[model samples]
Target: MANIKLALVDDHNLFRRGIASILGQVADFELVLEASNGQEFIEKIPRKMPDVVLLDLQMPVLDGTATADYLREHYPLIKIIVLTMHDEDRMVLHLLEKGVSGYLLKDSDPDEVEKAVRKVMDEGVYLNEFVSRAMLRKMTNKTTVVKQSTLYNSKILLSEREKEVLKLICEGLSTAEISDRIFLSPRTVEGHRLRILEKTGTKNTAGMVAYAFKNDLV
Candidate 1:
């Protein structure tokens, strides 16, 4: 199998070089490119797109938050792992909101770094140990800000009637069955389903089901 393509983006020259050198020892990873800062990363990314990006938060031009936002819009295919010294919850939460795959501290060992890169590439998410523990606490307490908000927006983005129709669709109801359940015509149920897809960014029945699964909307 080919190695996973990776990009290292940071403001500090020495730090970038050091990480590149360390990753060189990992045969399963290929250092496809490097960027000095977030702005440089955005400009160079399209030409040398990597499967996973190691992004530093504090950069001269375009910080990690901005970089992540742009990536979410333009390069949604790319997975971002935040590599930063700042462990502040505010910054971490902001990047999470912007759709980062991993949150790793600068002090992480090379082994941990390699693990994070590989895990996110495979699993779509890789949180550092500390970040994972914090996330666990927040989740247990029902204080995970984004999860709730995404669900809430998904709710308002689809009306109450739409949600009723969505739940039935997610339960594997056909348009005809949904029509019988909701007293609407089959064509009307389909229209509601289409609007639900538009509201929730789902492309098909499977995607709609997945959205429902992830947000507990079912």
Candidate 2:
């Protein structure tokens, strides 16, 4: 398999180098570019299109949120993992809704960072304990209003099988695992997953999960 091409965008030189060094040790990871801020990263995207980007939220010129928005609009296939110190639930939800593939704190274990990369590649999203807690907390908040949209009306939009598949997905079950649990072929499970994404108008599984929680679809 070709290596997973990676780009690092962070203002902190020491942090960028530290992450680059760790990712460099992985045989399947290739550090293709490094930028100190979002503007520089956006400028280099045409020349060095990375499969995944480790982006920091706080940066000069342009921020991670803006960069992520640009990527979602222009290069939807490239996965983004927010590597930052912020652990605020609201920020995590905001980024997830914008279609970021993962969120990892800077103090996370190095192995977790590597695992997050692989999981996002395979599963289309990587939700850690922190993210899960954030989702749960949001779910329990009575004041949180569910965004009403025709595309996200669960009864009107999703079939029974699709709902089942989505619930399993939110439970962190992979395609094969969901297949086994639901007594369907992996290909069939993937079909359901894709249709669910389409009906929900989500960019990836992370976005789908966020939508599910917010709209009480799962």
Candidate 3:
């Protein structure tokens, strides 16, 4: 495949710069554009399209939710991956219901962030471990308004490669270990980790294990 063009849409310049710098070292991806808010992201994208977008949930003019709605309405072909700090189950489900392809926490390490990018491009859903649990609980109760199958949809969305990542994560493998075992670069494993977190709604590996035990994924 050709190089993936990614756009960063977040209000924090420093965070955006940090992520860009990390992707730069990978030497195969490009941070094609950076925008402070959703409006700016829209304006920038009209001139060129990115394969994927790393969006922030909180922003001044256009938050990730509104931005996602607009993107889904207008540019259905473009994929969005939410990179945010919000761990609230409601907020996470809102983004997913908006059709975001991936979700990652802001506190996620840089390596996991990259894995998010790859998983979204290759698979379709990227969930953090903690986020997955919250989302699943809310989903099971049906109080969050996410349909019954939405959580199951997460499993269906992952590729075989991502499933491999999830199984290892549930088994307590660290990112570096997963990298070595999977023959993926560390950065790539990090990306997959982020993706797993988003898809399963689990935050850490331990949480993922609990989720597996609870759901019998193991």
Clash count of each predicted structure: 0, 0, 24
Candidate 1 residue 135 Cα shift, in angstroms, is 2.2
lDDT of 3 by residue, 102-145 (tens): 67888888888788787666645566676567655753664323
Overall local distance difference test of candidate 1: 0.75
Number of the predicted model whose lDDT against the real structure is largest:
2
Mark the 10 consecutive residues where model 1 has the least summed lDDT: 135-144
Per-residue CA lDDT of candidate 2, range 1-218, in tens?
99999999999999899999999999989999999999999999999999999999999999999999999999999999999999998899889989999999999999999999999999889999999999899888755645443335735568899989999999899999998998999999999988988887778889988888877787
Q: List ranges where model 1 is wrong by over 4 Å.
A: 136-218
Expressed as tens digits, the lDDT of each residue in 43-94 for candidate 1 is 8887898998999988887888888888888898888888999987556645
What root-mean-square deviation over C-alphas does model 2 reach?
2.0
Whole-model lDDT values for every prediction = 0.75, 0.91, 0.73
User: How does each model score on TM-score?
Assistant: 0.66, 0.94, 0.65
Candidates in descending TM-score order: 2, 1, 3
